[model samples]
Target: MQSPFDEPGRIFSNKRPLEEDYTPDTILCRDEEIDRYSEALQDVIEGFGPNNVFIYGQTGNGKTVVTRVMMDHLQNETHKHDVDLTILEVNCNKHDSIFNVLLELVNQLRDPDDQVKDQGPTKGYLWNTLYDELDRLGGDVLVVLDEVDMLGHDNDKLLYDFPRARKNGDLENARIGVIGISNNHMFKDELDPRVKSTLCESEIFFSPYDATQLSEILDHYAGLVFKDSVLEDGVIPLCAAKAAQEQGDAREALDLLETAGNIARKENADTVTEDHVERASDRVEEQRVLTIVRDQLTSQMKLALLATTFLNIDESAEPRAKNIYQVYKNICKTCGYEPRSKRRLNDFLDSIRLYGLLERDERNLGRAGGRSYIHTLEVEPELVFEGLEYDSDGDDSVLNQAGIVPSPEDTDQYSLESFGA
Candidate 1:
């Protein structure tokens, strides 16, 4: 059962710290936000009442992590006084609708013998049940709703009633406090004015960390993730700098380092170096584009995109939608799929433009010709082609024929009629 040839050294000490849910014991560069957040929840600590907190910021900001850290500290402190404090955390992304959220809450609270079905109860009945359960608990309850923007599927009935749990006489013993976390700033503004007033009583806006803050965050995680001296000099700085420019995302920085460490491990390299980080960055960017293509686009849509990219790259064709559609039809035949109608193909192009994979502009034709749209790839043409190649199985004969890799000069060259067909 022993395999001596398979044994190899790892560059990472631990990988848990790099994961999204793994909150480091010591949070870096968020003291000010944490202090303000704690103060917002001071009422719960003083045993006076509860508070409603609304936290909003861009992705990768320290909103959710900071809250979790403070919640841990709060729980420990409250337990010392023999207080019955319960924490109910729900990611609205996972449990989006009112019914799903209520069902999950009841599932967490109710006894195993009295477990509810996946879905059955009316909205009112569910709320009544939740209040009854919380009241029975006879303690302070903190319900932290992450991804609050996705709640109730376009309605805020649950959010409106969260802070009003006590006011509406839903609970008697357990004082319910709600903390709503959202990355979408418009979520609060679009809410009912009444809900907005109460839910956002203590609004804490978390700004993105600066480069120095990101660097500090990277350093903290690097020390935890890597062995004592296996890291190279410039790896952290480069990762930090890249992340800083991209909204100062600490998660992005950690991901870069993790990917670099993985690259080093795979290559059997001695140490994680700057070159590895550079390659990792490219890998991340490629994955980013590839994810958009592979996840969001249909098979025919990808073929259309490939055709457009080929036209843009090889033929120096006009970026007009019509021109692209002609090449798209040609590519569909090459790839053994029936080409879609022009109307439907234009719809795909519009969606691609919306995704920012490509850009579009309305162009005015002469009096005889009607107006049309011209488009260009927002990302590098080669990157999109490469991403498409990675997604495609087996050999890409269409890409080869289209000269995506730049073909040698041929005496007998194809005419524009072939591309149009």
Candidate 2:
């Protein structure tokens, strides 16, 4: 018997280039963004002091990568001029609150054995400690907060304080600058006016990549990751086109290409073809849908989605709001939980619609009739069942107790009319 690890896969020569955290040696199709970002950081390298920069873009639009590239350039240039500089980066996704953000910064600056504990420290104490450490360092310091929007408005004091530390006398010896990177375009508007003014002194926005740009990016990565002639001519273009049509996401395009390569390797195919890409697209979409359903949706939202999926499978016609509410109530009863009000249920439906799991159409009847909303599941019924079968508690969920299995061909077990809608 041969070990799985013993066999060398012919599809991918190196997979690191396809990973999310992998930084390419050269960035393609982002020259303008790089130039703007370079200008934003010019003061840091020229000894004028650091500038606060706020970068906004959708996911996979090269916001973080461009920041990293610019930071590298800034560091290299600063070294040439013998300038005193310190760079600190904290991902706000994990350290979300001001206290946690401060704690993380202190830990990064401190030795591992002398790091602060997670609890028992007040925000003011943390602030003072952070200021002391910064003052001790005594140079131009740039702090990067990635996923800055995750801090929300509650933790925005860091935004206002870090950029104004020098002017406010919080740090006598050290000068502070902040670089905030966020995926939400509206995050800047939500900040306090003072914080917004200081943090957004220089702003840059990254637009989604078009098909041509995605294709170029994909080709660059594919050439580095795959063996020569392993990819069919159409594979990159198909992946790029599909991703561009959906959201113009370069990350998704790259993932699609990588998944296609893995699929070909699994099948022992010599070359990655368009058929492999089509299958990989379905697989990637299913995984994405499952992740949203399991992680993002609340319990009530899951129930509402399951109710819609049941209707989508059992009824020939799309389910109306009234019909779904009735079925939703029954499911709640079967699960031994109280159902929310019909109005609240509709809100859940709309929320799920926003997640791309469901479709909603508004219709109006003529002659004094009110509006009606028709709902349909955007994904297949099987995916919804799998998504909801396991609750977060690791216990069997509503699907198990209700004995409801998704059978698109068999619609006799449940009916919308049975619920007296």
Candidate 3:
């Protein structure tokens, strides 16, 4: 039976579980991690002993996903045995302060009416609320602190307080366990000895996916995301191979597949092939560079990138930072924003260099030509500017101010010349 393309709902097919769509039931290909997690969590159910486990890995390496899934499973299994188990998950990035974290937990425990906000004495009061809530609950509790390293290295009090609370006589009935998930391996190394002892009872590391694993993961996603007729046989493998070569990141492989699928659909193609993947890679790579540019840039730095982009769009102007700054100052005037001074602007350019948006170089002129430094944009200014969300202006405000006119007949390729020899 052949499917018709005219039908809107059936156009694209997918087999992979997207990050948003990922669930305990749907997660696949992480058996080793699952086994280790389940083993560490089983003690709580069996009443033998609960272990504090730390999970560490790079972004999108399934640390949170697996921990959440395993914890959910543990909770369910514990419930069947008439055991009272509470798992509270908190993202430390948002609930960073001790008071805030305890407030969240207290809110979770208390009825809405009992929860107080403005009745603050100090953070000491909030810790009391947390203790009272846990003590009132009177059962075993598991605290999953995601991105725990964000709590700052010195503030290991929460780490010490949660797991050791039972042993330290903070709570009589509630046996507490802490599972800390972090992206940084050095987090444990930097931890204070007391906090480190509590949080590092067991540690599991998730290694990045290799090319084979990425291929398998992408194959699952491609089958679920694209239409059966949309993807040719080799497309998934190619995308996977490229992503693995760059970074053994599963999410990156999935992004590549999704982006390629999007491009194919936009082109109204019946079948996605290698050509679509290649084209999609260019667009995705451009977007990746743009994201790097956008995140690391301040408003003034963005203006610099915008200026460089505008210059690159102009046929005559060389993509130099000094020239770009001349244009940037004009842009700041047009946008009604105060311009940063030249020294400050230089700092912004140095940051842009760190972000890989632009390159800095020194030109050593032979005795005939004296040495001077130069600047250039490494990427296409038009693309970079689009990423920065800057708009184009028609009036040559920059040219008028600099007393420079662009030559229409100029033909030169801009290269990011290296600085410091």
Candidate 4:
């Protein structure tokens, strides 16, 4: 229904791609990794025993993306050889419980009947249905549990049952291969030795990308993600270098570049420049740190962080444990809440330190010959106060009086001029 010029120009025209839209098939580099991944699954493709692989890396570095691509290829090739193969990818964080995971598998495999989808069967029923479907399919199934470190103790049942399902008479026709992907390298150590032995049949390590590799990877994406003339020289390299130094996550580098481009467009700039990248990097870093803290913190811990910020802002208080506790008590009183005990508050401080928001240094009280720790907020106290509010029902008056409120002209500024002695 389209014109010839429209079709031809569209086909030949440059399509600017977003960094997140990148795919492995369109991935321009990492040939060596692809080869390694292919060879590792060669045995499984030949209809031999299924392979249980443990894949690990820092955060990104192409671990998940590579596995996704290789698995797709593996399934295709195996199917061509008349091998009945099914691949199921589940993110373990959301499906942490074995029951939840089994439910997910059943939901995926089940027909879209209203009864089946809505009023789902019980765990035992689902497990029976799962085995029944697998036996009916009569082939090899590869189950990729991504973020498998989140499996917690609930994973033991599946880890014990699935692999040994055949000998245990749980399944007759289907063979299951589990490929667990995790950022935590110590996850295997926490597993039962028997489960570890089964899951660790083959292990693949994905190393962090160096600056050069990151730039190369970013370069491939820049062409796809930006207008040809939008990116200035050296911008990609700078973004890549910054991300590589911090986490060596290729996905982060890509996200940085894409974010920079978006920022440029927002500012109505002609091109994506180093300044844009720098601002983008700061924004990304701030978001990343805050996200990490938010996930690790509980409501009480967040309240403690706010209390510390209030102490840092109050002119009469020091940022020490005692002073922070007083401010915490005041904040709780103003918000119509009860402050936890000092010991509990100390525990909260420890939690925030573990969350990387505060730094606590232990030193000896010289004359008294006692040990005490000085606590300092690592980031702007204002951000901490604001972030805590996301999970708190604290009065808005508390924020305003403490000067933790953001200003329209300078949302990024957090002055310590109000720091208490």
lDDT of each: 0.75, 0.82, 0.69, 0.69
TM-score of each: 0.70, 0.74, 0.68, 0.69
C-alpha RMSD by candidate, in order: 8.9, 6.6, 9.9, 8.7
Per-residue accuracy of model 4 over 299-386 as CA lDDT, tens digit each: 4555577667655555555577776777667656555566777866775676466445788988776876567777877886545544
Ranked candidates, highest TM-score first: 2, 1, 4, 3
Alpha-carbon deviation at 214 in model 1, angstroms: 1.1
* Residue-level lDDT for 88 in candidate 2: 95
User: What's the lDDT for candidate 2?
Assistant: 0.82
Q: Tell me the spans in candidate 1 whose CA falls farther than 4 Å from its real position.
A: 1-6, 288-421
Residue-pair clash count for candidate 1: 0
The alpha-carbon deviation from the true structure for residue 100 of candidate 1, after best TM-score superposition, in angstroms, is 1.0
Report the alpha-carbon TM-score of model 4 versus the true structure.
0.69
**Cα lDDT tens digits for candidate 1, 1-421:** 7753423556777878777679778987888888889899887777876688999987678888898989999999788867678999988756756788888898799888998888667878888888888988888888899877655224467888877878887777888888999866767776888889888889999898888888888988888888878888888889999888876767667878888998888887779999999889988766666656754455666776766665565554676777888888877776667887786676567546544577777878878768988777778765665555544454554445545332223312434456563
- Candidate 3, residue 86: Cα displacement in angstroms equals 0.4
Which candidate comes out best when scored by TM-score? 2
For candidate 2, write residues 27-85 as lDDT tens digits: 89999988888888888888999999999877788988888887887888999998889
Off by over 4 Å in 3: 1-7, 14-16, 19-21, 24-26, 118-121, 285-421
Error of 3 at 300 (Å): 18
